[model samples]
Target chain A: MTDQTTNWPDHLTGDAQPLEVGILLYEGHTALDLVGPYTTFALAGMKVHLVAETLDPVVSDDGGMTIAPTTTFDDCPERLDILFVPGGGMVYKPMLDPATIAWLADRGATASYITAVCNGPLVLAAAGLLDGYRVATHWASRDQLARLGVEVSTERVCIDRNRFSGGGVTAGIDFGLTVVAHTLGEKAARFAQLVMEYDPEPPFNAGSPESAGPEIVALRTRFMAEPDTALRNAVSHVLEQRAATSSHPVSDENADPAAGIVND
Target chain B: MTDQTTNWPDHLTGDAQPLEVGILLYEGHTALDLVGPYTTFALAGMKVHLVAETLDPVVSDDGGMTIAPTTTFDDCPERLDILFVPGGGMVYKPMLDPATIAWLADRGATASYITAVCNGPLVLAAAGLLDGYRVATHWASRDQLARLGVEVSTERVCIDRNRFSGGGVTAGIDFGLTVVAHTLGEKAARFAQLVMEYDPEPPFNAGSPESAGPEIVALRTRFMAEPDTALRNAVSHVLEQRAATSSHPVSDENADPAAGIVND
Candidate 1:
C-alpha cells in the first residue's frame, strides 16, 4: 500500500492534493456511521464521495433518512486515499451481495487505507479482507467477527497496519481523526476537531454495555434480537462459502457450533 | 409549553408514541450540527424530519454534501416534540430571512422543546426566542450571540426553560441525548447511547480554544475572518430591525460595540 504521508508534504501550508475518500453507501446502513467520518474528513478538506451500486438515494436503517450517493461503484475513483464501509440493520444484505463484496475486494487491494465502523467490519470480513487482520467492530458483533477468524480489538478505534476500524457507529469520528492524523498530520486533525468541536460529553455514563448495566443491556439485547438473527444467518452463509472453497470439509471447530445452524 | 413527559407514559416497555423531531435544514448549514443529533435522536426512536424551506437538496457549507429535506416548512407538522436548528457559514443568511425566522417563531412558540447547535442560537435569538434566555453557542460566535442580548452559557449544553442550546457542532449529540433523557427517560437515552457507541475518544484534546492553546486558536481565528464579518453584518441588521420596531433606539451598550459595524 502507498504511504499517504508522501502525498501530503510536511509543509502543507497551502499546496496539497485533496485526499480522495470513498465511503460505501448501501440500503439500511446506519446514517451516523457514514456522516460522522464524512463530517470529520470533509472538515479536514478531504474530498469525500458517497459511493453505492447506483446513483439512487440510499435509505438508512431507520427508514427515516435518505442519502444520495455521489458516485456509483462503476464510477468511483480508481485510486482512493481512504475506502470506508458503515454498518447497520440491513448490513447482512450487503454482506451477501456478490457485487458489493467484489467491489470491496477490488478496492481493498489498492486503497491506501481500508476502514469500517460498527458491523461494517463484518462486510469486510465476508469479503475476505479481514481473513487474518485484527480489527475492531461493534461490541454486539465481536463474537461474530471472532467466528470469522478475525481478531477483534476492544478499542473504540483500532489501527492495525493500513486497516483502520472503529467500534460501532459514533466511533467513526474517532477513526476519522486517527486517519487524518496519520495522513494529514496531528495539526490538521486537531484543526478539524476544533472546527467540528469534537469534544464529547455524554450526559450519562452508559455508552457501553459495561457502563449501561445489566438491565439496560438486556433491554438493548432484546431490542436487537431480530437484527441479531439476520447477522447470525449472514455469518453462517459466509462460513459455508469458506468451507465450500477450502478442500477441508466443514468442521464444528470452524463454526460457532451454537449459531452454525443455517436458517432456511 | 406542554410537558412531553405526559405524552410518554411511565410504563413505556412496548407502547410509546414516536418522538416528533423537526430539524431545520438550510443552505450552507454545517452538516455535523444537524447529523450528530439526527443520528442520536433517530437511534433513540425519534421521528426526525429534516425540515427546510423546500424539498430540494440543501447543500452544506463545505459544498461536499447535500441533504434532501423530508418536509417543507409549510408542510411540517404543526406540533413537534422538538424543534432544532443547525449553524454554519451561511447561518446569518437564515437568521435574517423573514420566512425562516417566521417559521421558527411559530414552531418554537409551541414546540415542546426548542433547540439549536453552534451559532444556530443566533437564529433563535433573531426570532426573539432567546431574548432574556441563557443559551450556549459556538465559541467563535460567543461574542456575536452575546451581542444579541442572549446570556451565553459556557457549558457544552445549556437548557434554559424549554430552550436547549448546544455549543458548536459536535455538541448536538450531547444535546440530543439530554433531550432523550428528559422526554423518554434515562434508560431509553442510555440504550441509544449503547447502540450508537457514543463513548467519544478524540485523538487530540484541542477541541476548544481553551484546550487548543493560543496558536491554534489564532490560526482558527484567521481562518474564520470572512465568516466573522458576515456574522457581524447579520447582527447589525438584526439590531437595526429591532430598533426600528421598538420605541427605544439601538443602544451601544446592548451591542458588542466591537462587532456592531456592517462592513458593506
Candidate 2:
C-alpha cells in the first residue's frame, strides 16, 4: 500500500508465508473490533490468524462470538505482519494479563504493524509501544492516550506507519483497507474492495461520538461512566508504568505521569 | 420466518446450548461474508458455533484467513435458533454435499433464519428453499437467480425475513446490522451501530458489478465465465420437480419460486 502511511516489509522468511495478521481475542472484548478487521484483512488476502492466551475459546464481552484460537501464545507463528488489539469492557483484565501484554509488546517490537481498535490502544499505551508516537483509538480513550504521552485524535481511523489505530470497531474496515493498500499494494487492495462491495452506505448518518449528535453522545457517554473510572483507576495501577513511562523515556520506571504525560 | 419462502422446522428443539452457526469455509469464499456477520450476532450475545464438513483448517479464496472450525456437520449443535449459511465461492460445493444440503434443509426447516451472503443464497436455492420466493444473492449471480425463476436485483443487501441476503462480502456488516435490528430492538441495533461507527465511508466508490466500472466489470465477468456455466447448469437441476402441497402449506419439494419470496 503506497498510501500516506505505510512501510512494506523489506524481506520475507521463506516460511514467512504471506503477511500474517494476528488478532488477540479474550473475554469481555468487543467482538466487532476483532471481526471487523478480520473481515477487511481476510478480504485483502492477508493471512489473518485469530490468537488467544490458550487453545480454548475466547469469549466476547457480550457473550457473543466465542472464537477458538488456531494457535496459543506459546505456539504463535514465528512472527506477525500486523498485530491487532480489540477492545471490550474487560480490557483492563486482558491488559493486565502478563501473557497478553508481553505478547503484544514482544510482537510490537518487530511486527510490521501494531494496531488497535476502540480502547485497544490503551493496551498498547500500557505496553509502552505508544511512547513518542502518534496514535488513535476510541474517542472515549482519547484523553487517556494523551495521558500516555501519545498524540491522540478523534478521527475514525488513523494509520501512523507501523502504528495503525482506529476510532472504533467500524473503523476496522477502513483501517484494514488502508493497511491492505499499504501491505499488498493498491491494485490488489482495490481489487479486493471491488469484489467485496466495500462501498458502504450506512442507513443512518451517526457513527462516532462527534458524528452521532449531542443527546445521543451524552447518553452514550453517561452510560460509559463506570468503565471510565474503572479504566482510569485500574489502568493506573495494573499498567503502573504509565506513571513512570509518561514522564521519562519508556525505558524509565520512575517517570511521573502527572508531570510528564502530554496534554496539548 | 413466517414468510416461508423456505422451510421452517416442524419441531424445532429450542435448546439454547446446541444451536450452532455452520459457516462454510474453503478456498475462494469471500472472507468478510463469514466474519462480518460472525461478529454481529456474536456481539448480540449469540454463540456463533463455526461448523465445517471436516476438521481440517479451511482456507479462504484469497488465501487470507485460515479458520479452524469448532465442529463438523455430524458433531454440530443439534438444536439451533439460527442456522447461518455464510456465502462465498465455496457455496457451489454445498450442492455437491448432500449431507450439507440436507442438513441445511433440515435445520432451516426449524432454525430461526437461514441467512446467506454473496452467493450463499444460491446454496438456499440449491436446497430448493428459494423456489417460488423472491430471493437475492451476489450481484454477479443475478442472471443465475433469474434462471432459477427468482426475481433479482443489485441491492447491497436484502432481508427476506428468515432468509437474510447480503449483497457481497462487505454487505455482511449491513446484514448483521439489519439482523440486529430485526432480532433485537432497533435501539439495540442502533447501539451496536453507534459502537461500531457503522457509517461506512469507503475510500473508493466501487463495490457492485454495475458500480465497479465497465472495464473491471468486464474483467470480473470474464473471470466468472466458468462459474456461470456451472451455476446455470446446477441451478437448473435444482429447479426440477413438482409440488404436491396446499396453497399455503410448507415443505413442498417442487415449491413455486415466485410466490413466497417477497419483492422489496
Candidate 3:
C-alpha cells in the first residue's frame, strides 16, 4: 500500500487510483495556460501527466519553462478525469493534421471531460467537440470561435458539460479550480483554494482585451489577426477531414510529428 | 544598448547583464508561491535566479516544483530590482541565518523593491524591514507580523514604497503584474497583462483563508496551529540575530552549493 495521503481511503472496499489528469503540451503554447492549472490541480493531489504529441520538451509561448513532456498522446492511458488543453503561439498544424484531429475527435467523446484554456479551445473546435457548446476563448480568438458555431463568451471561464473553456492564459487557474470543485466536491476544493489563496488584485484593474485602453488593445488585436486566420484555415481542414470518415480517424500510428511547426 | 523590450527609453536600464530576479528558496516553500510567479516572470523573459542558503533544490510545502538554486545567498548580486520571497515550510532557519538575513538587510536599502507572497513577509519582518510598514502575509501569519510591529492588513496586496506583500501564494501573479507596472510604465505593464490575459474568475468565488466554509476553515485553523508555533520560534530567533548584528552582516562570498548535495 502506498503512503500517499488521500491515495487510499482506509474504509473503501475496493482500491481506487487518484484521478489521472492529462494536460496537452505543444510547441509555442502558453506556459501559464498550462502551469496555472497544473499547479492548482497537482496541489490537490491529482495524478497529472504532461502529454504531448511526442515526448519532446515543449517550448512555451514565450521562451521560458521548456517543459519536457512525460508521455506521448499515443502512450497515455485512456483513463482521465480531465483532459486539459493549453494554448499559445498559433501552432495550428497539430489541429489541422487529419490524423491528429481524428484522434482528438475520437477520444474526446469517450474522455471523462475535455477542457481548453486560452486559444486551446481552437483545437476543440477543430475536433468537432465544441459544436453547439457555449465556450470561451482568448479575447483575440473569440470571434473565430463564434464563426465556428460555438457560443463564445467574454467570461474568464465558461463550462458546458464535459467541454470547458477559458478566456486567456491567466484564466486557466480559475477554470482549474472550478473543475476541482466539480470533481472533488466542495470540501476538497475549498481546502485547495485556501492553500492557493486564489483571490487576485491586479494593480491597474485592467484585464480584458477590450478594456486595456484603446491603443494597446488595437495593437495586439492587429498583430494577432493574421495568425488567427491561418489557424482558422487549419481548423476548417480538420472539420472536412472528420466529415470524410465516420470511424475513429485518428490512430496512434498516424499522428504526424510534422504537424507541429505552425505560426509559432 | 540591449535589444530587450525592457530596455526601451521608457523602461529602466542598468548593466547590460541579465536582469536578475531572485526567488528566495527555502525548505517547505509553497510550490506555486514561487512557481506561479517564477513561471510568470520567467515567461516574461527575465533572468530568474533561485537563491538559497545553499544551492540545493528546495522542496515546496506540497512537495511539488522541486527546484535547484541558481546561486546561494553569498554569491547573489548586490543590486536587484525584484527580490521575491515565497512562503511555505521551514522559513525560520533561512530567515535567521545571518547570511540570508544580512544580505536582505543590506540590499533592503537599495533594492528596486522587496516583495513577498503569502507568509513570505515574515522573512522581511525578520530582517526588520516591515517594522513600520503596512504588510500582509498568509492569513494565518498576519498576527505573527503584528507582533513584530508590522501594520497588518486584510488586503490581498499591500504595496508600500519599495515593499510589496500579498495575502498568499495565488496572489503572486497580481503582485507580479503590480511590480511590473511599478518598474515599467502603464503601457508595458498593460501589454504584459494583456499578453497574459490577466482575467481571473474563480469557480466558487471562495479563495481566502477566511472565505472557505466554516468546517474547512476550522480544520485548517486547527491544523496550522502547530506549525505556527515553529514560525513564531523562528521569528524570535531572527529577532535575536538582528539584535546581535550591527549592520550588513551577510557575507557576499559568492554563492556556494550546500555540502553533500548536488543540483541536477
Q: Which prediction has the highest TM-score against the true structure?
A: 1
Alpha-carbon TM-score of each model against the true structure: 0.92, 0.75, 0.75
Q: What is the alpha-carbon lDDT for the whole of candidate 1?
A: 0.83
Model 2 C-alpha lDDT per residue in residues A1-264, reported as the tens digit of each score: 123213222211223246778888777787667766777675444667777887776666655345567677778875788888888877787767778889888888878788888889888877778876777677666666566557776566676768887777777777777777777666545655676777675655567655667755665565567777777765667445554545743323224433333233
| Docking outcome class, model 3 | acceptable
Candidate 3: which pairs clash?
B75-B254, B75-B255
Give the whole-model CA lDDT for all candidates, comma-separated.
0.83, 0.65, 0.68
C-alpha positional error of residue B84 in candidate 3 after TM-score superposition, expressed in Å: 1.6
lDDT (Cα, 0-100) at A232 in candidate 3: 65
Per-residue accuracy of model 3 over A13-49 as CA lDDT, tens digit each = 2255566788877777776787778877765557777
RMSD of each: 4.4, 7.4, 9.1
CA deviation > 4 Å runs, candidate 2: A1-17, A25-29, A49-57, A68-81, A210-230, A242-264, B1-31, B42-83, B110-114, B159-163, B218-264
State the iRMSD of every prediction, in order shown: 1.6, 4.1, 3.1
Lowest lDDT sum, 10 consecutive residues, model 3 chain B, at B253-262
Question: TM-score for chain A of every candidate model?
Answer: 0.91, 0.83, 0.80
Clashing pairs in 1: none
Query: What tens digits encode model 2's per-residue C-alpha lDDT throughout B212-240?
Result: 67866765555556766676666655554
Q: Which prediction has the highest lDDT against the true structure?
A: 1
